[model samples]
Target: MGLACAVAWLAALTVYDVRQRRLPNALTLPGAVIVLITAALAGRGAAALLGAVALGALYLVMHLTAPSAMGAGDVKLAIGVGALTGAFGVDAWVLATVAAPLLTAAWGIVGFRARGGGATGRIAVPHGPSMCVATVAAVAVVVI
Candidate 1:
């Protein structure tokens, strides 16, 4: 049940971020609450809490130091990702965190290449899809 909800939330977030290039507080805030509540109900509250706090802190620092790279919405969405993956275990949470930026970087490179290698401007790539994919991949590994 928790996993399903998490997946659904991720799907919605991915679509929204891809379309708008922004993660709205309206969705992310409520999604965080749902993930946390579901985690607690599933008897993984400790792990979930730890993951949320750890990832939230990590993203917060990134946002503070590199505002242009990380957005507040991404920070908020991290809490939900942490809660979902953390419910599985610390390994899942850690893996998701590590994979997200790598995935984003890889995607950005692919996109850059696809657009021809002559452009030198900064491209705005949505990080939410990377986050969602990493979270789902981590969860799948832990669950199966």
Candidate 2:
């Protein structure tokens, strides 16, 4: 049930991000809260919640330091991701992190090819969708 909810949440986030190129805190905040509470109740403990917050902060720092590479929206979305993956433990977080960038790179390469290499740098991608795919793939790989 938790996994299902996480999947749906990621899907909704992806749609919103793709449409608006922003991940509103309105979505991520509530999602972070809910997932954290759920994980705590399910025996994952408060550590997961703290981990999520830390992850958000880490992303925030990256966004501030390299705004061209990271965005506020991605930082916000990381809150929910941190909660969900942290509940499962470090392996999930590692998988998601590794997968997200690799998948993003792959998508970027494909887009570059499709565009005849005209996009010089930092093409705006609907990264929420890429994250969603990466998160799901990570979960699948870890679980199966």
Candidate 3:
């Protein structure tokens, strides 16, 4: 059940990010809640919350320091990212947290080079997809 929810949640958010370049509160806000509810049922609420808070804080700082570099939607998406991967353990949570931004940065560099976004001052990459991908990869690591 948890796995299914995570897969569906990741898929929805990823598609939204790719197409819209933003994660709607409609998906991100409720996603955190759903992840927490399932985590609580699994007796990992504390860890799950920790993941959400940690990742959210990281993205929050990134968004605060550089508005163009990271968007508010990414911060919001981090909540779900944290909870889902955090439930697995500190390892999973840490991996997801670290991997997401690294993935985004890599993609940003590629996109910037390929399409020439240097004139725009910043390379725009949808971070929600990175977060979603990292969470799924981390969870898979823990599960298998």
The best candidate in terms of lDDT: 1
Residue 3 displacement (Å), model 1: 1.5
Q: Give me the displacement of residue 7 in model 2, in angstroms.
A: 0.8
Q: Give each prediction's root-mean-square deviation over alpha carbons.
A: 1.1, 1.9, 1.8
Could you estimate the TM-score for every candidate?
Answer: 0.95, 0.88, 0.91
Clashes of each: 0, 0, 0
The whole-model C-alpha lDDT of candidate 1 against the native structure comes to: 0.89
Error of 1 at 135 (Å): 0.2
In TM-score terms, which candidate is top? 1
Model 3: residues with Cα > 4 Å off, grouped in runs: 116-122
How are the candidates ranked when ordered by lDDT, highest leading? 1, 3, 2
Ranking of predictions according to TM-score: 1, 3, 2
The per-residue C-alpha lDDT of model 1 at residue 113 equals 83
Give the distance in Å from residue 98's predicted Cα in candidate 1 to where it truly belongs. 0.7
Candidate 3, residues 40-109: lDDT per residue as tens digits? 9989999999989988898899999999878898898888888888889998988888898899899988
Off by over 4 Å in 2: 119-122
Clashes of 2: 0
